[model samples]
Target: MRPYLFLFLLGIVLFFATCRKKDTTPTPSTPVVPGCTSLLAPANGGFVTTTSVTLSWNAVSTASSYDVYLGTTPSPTTLVGNAVSGTTHTVSIPATPNVTYYWYVVPRNTTGPASGCASGARSFTYIVISMPVSLGYHVVGYFPSYRSLADVPDIKFRMTNVVVYAFYQVNSAGSLLAPGSATAPLAAVATKARSNNAKILLGINDGSGDGKTNFKNMAASPQGRTNFIRDIMNVVRTNQLDGVDMDWEFPTTSDGTDVTFTSLMQELADSLHRDGRYYLSCAITAGKYAGGIRDAIRNELFPIVDFFNIMAYDDFSTTTPYRHHSDYALASLCLNYWINTRGMPAAKAVLGIPAYGRPSGITQSNTVLSYRNILSQGGNAQLDSAIVSAGTFTNYTIYYNGQYTVKRKAKLSKDIAAGVMFWEKWQDATDGQSLLKAACDTVGRSY
Candidate 1:
């Protein structure tokens, strides 16, 4: 064998070895097109109470990202989110009620997007709340004497049709207790409320102890009822109030107080309605749970009262996934119980929405944080539950209705009830994050 031939063969072997090494390095392969995602939330043809909605879909295996499209038409030409990495996309714009909205999610990989995604688009109807035009919707707020009047925004007074000056206590004998230090504040608030074109009412309730015992005793006898009505009217006249709101915590059927309660309410309504210029309202229980507490508000008193403020908050359920004290579900149930089960008129049903939230793992009465304080302590406005440090506990998960839920509830009120009512006006935030403002905005009421 010649040296030149052997050298040439060795060089060829080296060249072949280099080529093999190069072949060992992996070559890039084209990515497979992702499968179409399945829409999960806001079920097709379903109704959504909230303006802000979260659009969610089942993740596709090969999907690197997703494109979300939403619009009024079936095809949904508007591109809401592009290249969204997650399976969910929260709608940033507020949805209009009574409008049908269509959405499409297109799963995509490096190769291309899934085909026929728009053809399989889903749709949902934003509920249209038909509010009465004749009577006009009422936004009622309870102004408690304990809270500083300055904390309440001036816009709140104007937003509310009725501002209740809470709790001028009543004795067992049906005589009114002195306002004492609250008199000046009451007068000031009443004056402000009246100036804002809001009807201010004097709220009467049983004093400190014995729950509804004082109210029960007062309403039991004719003389006591007469005395109570007289004092209420006198107080209304003195305060220049438009009417009276009876806050009898509860008058149970088991004790026969419910019977007397009807009589008392009838008498009060007669006296207040005589001039045809005053309103008579009552703060009733949520009626979510079964018991004497629910049956307290008898059906007979429906016609006697102008409106019943259904206290729908402070609900506690151990079996629920999240222990939300004032959840939207509870509000719906309360309204159904009042208007459907009990046969109360929809126009007279005023749903109550709390301005405060209760912490998880804590009793409803044990811990309550106002919406403003919750936001100040790192509460998320978008999410319903927030992890925050409250009192001795660190990283406590507090469950409350955020701005979204408040707006949802307000919309719910317009759908089936006269209006929405807050437990206390001062509990709301002063800024744009104000729960009152959210509610008013949803109901199309300017604040």
Candidate 2:
């Protein structure tokens, strides 16, 4: 009831109100420590193979050990494993194919009874391939002439599982014949092959020779074209051959032949498929020119044939010992380009490896040799590299130092499709060690 007492009460009330305001305002929380020092493996946002992914990370500072966890939801995670005083740790994840998984790491400091939780979680995804396998091979076939037809049964029987065989010819001069009417035996041999439960492909390719021009004529002219198709189909029907393989040396518009060659191939594919029989295949040239043409083929025939065999070996020749056709780099490069960029499916592509080498004096210019012959000339290791069976040619290209080299064409076979097909069977070693065998093993092919 007195002014002094009333004023004193008001002051007390004002002071209490100020204190309440300060207490009501929230205080900032300590910045939560980050999860782990660092992470790896299915690296940050990485794509990985296999259902179990290994999650790893560096241990946090002042931490004596680490613990890892993963889950589909946030926090209160499922622990994967714990490591002691280590900078890094790996945790195996059990996940289904094509599913994304989230994981995190926690650091444990000896000072505390419990380990500290990670600041956040890291995530990864997994992909599962049905079967990841490949095939490889050396020379496919070899026949001096029609006289070699008698050897067809022997060759096919001997190389029971050979998927492809190259046919060769000898001109009137008795020299190795390039593509011509002289190589007609191919059609008959292919027929015999089919009857024997084997597949045969004629060798109609000639690298770095005028034979390319002859090939263009054969593909362009109606008569030559019909003969070519007839020879192949006849072999298919009579010998029961599985397919026809075109081995034109190379097709380039530089000489106005690229378009024609492509047209020929498309026409043949259409014709062959219409019959509802015979597999159509081809050995596309390797390197820039080969690569360019293959890109065109993929656009034209990705859905046409059984597979496209790219001759990846011999980027260079014996003349350039440092560079040659069997160069692994070129082989891998062509494979990646076609499969990854050219829109060709991995299963529909085959990488060609040489069974032989070029003589040393030969230049980067295309030259081929037989693997069997190269083996006798100190190329044993090289030949062995290809993992072949009998009835496959060893195209012998001479290296500069007389140390002949063979291409280990098998490496890619197990990872790619269709398998390796070669140029000639006669050029192969008769000792039962041939490229066909190697390829069969790699791709799990039988017969």
Highest lDDT against the true fold, candidate = 1
Give the worst 10-residue stretch by lDDT in candidate 1. 127-136
What are the lDDT figures for the candidates, one per model?
0.82, 0.54
User: Per-residue lDDT tens digits of candidate 2, residues 357-436?
Assistant: 55433432444446665565556533223222223333433531111222234556446544554544555555545555
In candidate 1, what are the lDDT values of residues 1-447, reduced to their tens digit? 699999999999999987784446777889899888889988999867678889999999899999999998999889899999998998854555568889989999889999999998999877533222224688988888777877776787888888999778888567988555663378888988988888888888888576688888788899999898998888887877888888888888889998898899887876676536578889999998788877878888887788888999877553454688888999999999899998999999999988777775555453568778889988877668887776666676778878899889899989988999998788777888888888888888875
RMSD after CA superposition, every candidate: 26.5, 19.2
Please estimate how well model 1 matches the true structure, expressed as its whole-model Cα lDDT.
Answer: 0.82
Per-residue lDDT for 193 in model 2?
58
Clash tally, candidates in order: 0, 61
